[model samples]
Target: MPRRHDPERRQRIIDAAIRVVARAGIAGLSHRSVAAEADVPLGSTTYHFTTLDDLMVAALRQANEGFARVVAAHPALSDPESDLPGELARVLGAWLGGDRTGVELEYELYLAALRRPALRPVAAEWAEGVGALLAARTDPVTARALVAVLDGICLQVLLTDTPYDEAYAREVLTRLLPAPGTRDGRGPGSLPPPTAG
Candidate 1:
């Protein structure tokens, strides 16, 4: 008789690969390391991912999925006309405030893409995910720019352990937002009034 397979084993391996990268960084990741972390046979790692890049890409994609959940939960994103800065600050605070290792792991993949051209598409997908989320609340141009700024701020927080304070987030937003009553008439750079009292 054929042996029964664990239906969740594949996902568990993927989750384990992320954990290994989170704890040890990408340089330490390997099929052997991941198998040890996952407590699975080395064959399982090979069975799931034929190459290291494949494993890293899977981990990056998984991280993106988690970020998407955060974006989906933010209230301001649901209504484009609502106060964005405060809501965005709150959303970012919630995202960056927890789990430093996870944040580090994300930056690891981000930086890795710079050195490895093969990973660039995964990096672009990650950036485009944020851009699309922001576009829900603003025009594509502003969304693209804001995503870049947001990534910078996030990198700062990740590197310096800077407080993910709402005031700081608002300050950044203030610079990017258009002056009130611009000719565009609430399009693109125009933003809702500050929500913070």
Candidate 2:
């Protein structure tokens, strides 16, 4: 069979960049290093991605798409009108309340994005998607808060040897957020009234 030009092999490099960033953060990314990890030719790296920005953009795209895929993977995660307190919590728990490699990978991906300007937009897009998901039942301010909380809780779990409790996370965030339709997702309005009582 003839080779497939415009092949997914390029995507493979991008995906590997995400993994490498997940494994080693931004410092670990390089055309040659990623090429080795992907087991493709180093020249293929230059052939597929000529600039660092292109590579970073590709990696960010991979990460953003991957997270969205995970969110879409669950039926409950997409439906904001559901019993959000319970469902949102479950989704948050599933996404971060475990010791899953994805959470760890996300940490690395985010950390790498911090120093890499080219990748910053990639991170922002992913954040916006997650924020939008949370905003479904709450306001934008809270949506941002929710992502922060999830990341914080994940960090806590990462630091500790103790077992994770998805239930607790669900309960806590449920109490913190307002009910669905209480507000129209911080759209065309000022921020949600000061959340802290």
Candidate 3:
């Protein structure tokens, strides 16, 4: 037999790994399972990923892009003068509203990082990426805080099966922003006390 030329084999395997995780979670992800899901020969998966961790890293990296794409589609998120909190809430709402499976799948793989050291960097990348996007409009501290709040909100909604309240999210996110004329939500905006006579 001759060798085959499948340029997309690697990507297919990654996609399959995501599907497998979505269906059976990280516990069910293996080269054999990914091969079956990808409809490729078992050897292909092994050739592309030397270990289960390698496959998981690839799948998680790809899954992290889902929310990034949603954020990218919303230009307001990057605009300094825009209602950043509202935009973030709207973007989150859009992400959570569309393709519930994808949102859940992304979180599942992301949360798996808690147990798998190999996945920690990939999970951090997601937060750093979003934080960077937000950093463009606010101080880095606030940007990071926004990411943390967003993560908490998402987990709460997913875990509790509660409907996403865009209004509440916006309010909370807005509170994270630095006060007007202040920097990093500190005392910069406060008027100094009158000097003693």
Candidate 4:
């Protein structure tokens, strides 16, 4: 019989690479290590990923995809009246409290982008996704600024053991938003309709 392609094997290798980065940092990633982690022959890794850079790119893309999904599913992203900052704070707190590994992996990918230009697009994609969600409630400038602020807060939380403070986050985000009744020349108790992406 002619040989058949094993599609899952490629994904398994990518998953193993991510796990390796999460546990040991990107420096520990290697075909041998990923193959061993995935319980596949070392050759399988090379067959799927021609080089370490290729593997890392795949891993970074995968991580970004997961992050986008989490953000997309956030209630605040969908609810116009939801407390955006509070939702962000809650998510950040949960991530810090129990999902440290994922946070670490994400940071690792960001660091990797410093040396690999190819990996930079992955970061841009993440930022764009976040910006689109924020744009729904604010102007483009405010949306961009919010993205930057959110990133700074997340980085600070990751670097230090500071517990996420929802009130503080809300205050910061509120500063970025237009006063409750003034945006787009609307009257009191009004909010701008969400911008369509």
Top candidate (lDDT): 3
Q: What is the lDDT of candidate 4?
A: 0.75
- lDDT for each residue of candidate 2 in 1-197, tens digit (9 for 90 to 100): 34447468977888888777777767778888899988887898888899967887876676666567667777775565565545655665566654466676766666666677877877888788889887876789888888887777667777785555665665556555755435324222223233221
Q: Candidate 1 overall Cα lDDT vs. reference? A: 0.77
lDDT of 4 at 37: 95
State model 3's lDDT.
Answer: 0.84
Please, what are the lDDT tens digits per residue for candidate 4 over residues 1-197? 33257768888889999999999999899999999999888888998899898998999989987677666656665577666655665555555566789988987887788899888887788788778877886777888988898778777777886765655665566567656734423333223342211
Candidate 1, 1-197: lDDT as tens digits: 33248788888888998999888899899999999987888998998889888888888888877777877887566686666755677777777777777678878987888887778899999888788877776778877877877888887877786666566675676466545634224344444464432
TM-score of 1: 0.83
lDDT of 1 at 75: 59
Count of steric clashes across candidates, in order:
0, 0, 0, 0
Winner of 1 and 4 under lDDT: 1
Q: Which pairs of residues collide in candidate 3?
A: none
On the 0 to 100 scale, the lDDT of residue 146 in model 2 is: 81
Number of the top candidate by TM-score?
3
Across 54-79, the per-residue lDDT of candidate 3 in tens digits comes to: 99899889988877788789987777
What's the CA RMSD for each of the models? Answer: 4.3, 7.3, 8.3, 6.5
- Provide the clash count, candidate 4: 0
Instruction: Score every model by TM-score.
Output: 0.83, 0.73, 0.87, 0.82
lDDT of each: 0.77, 0.69, 0.84, 0.75
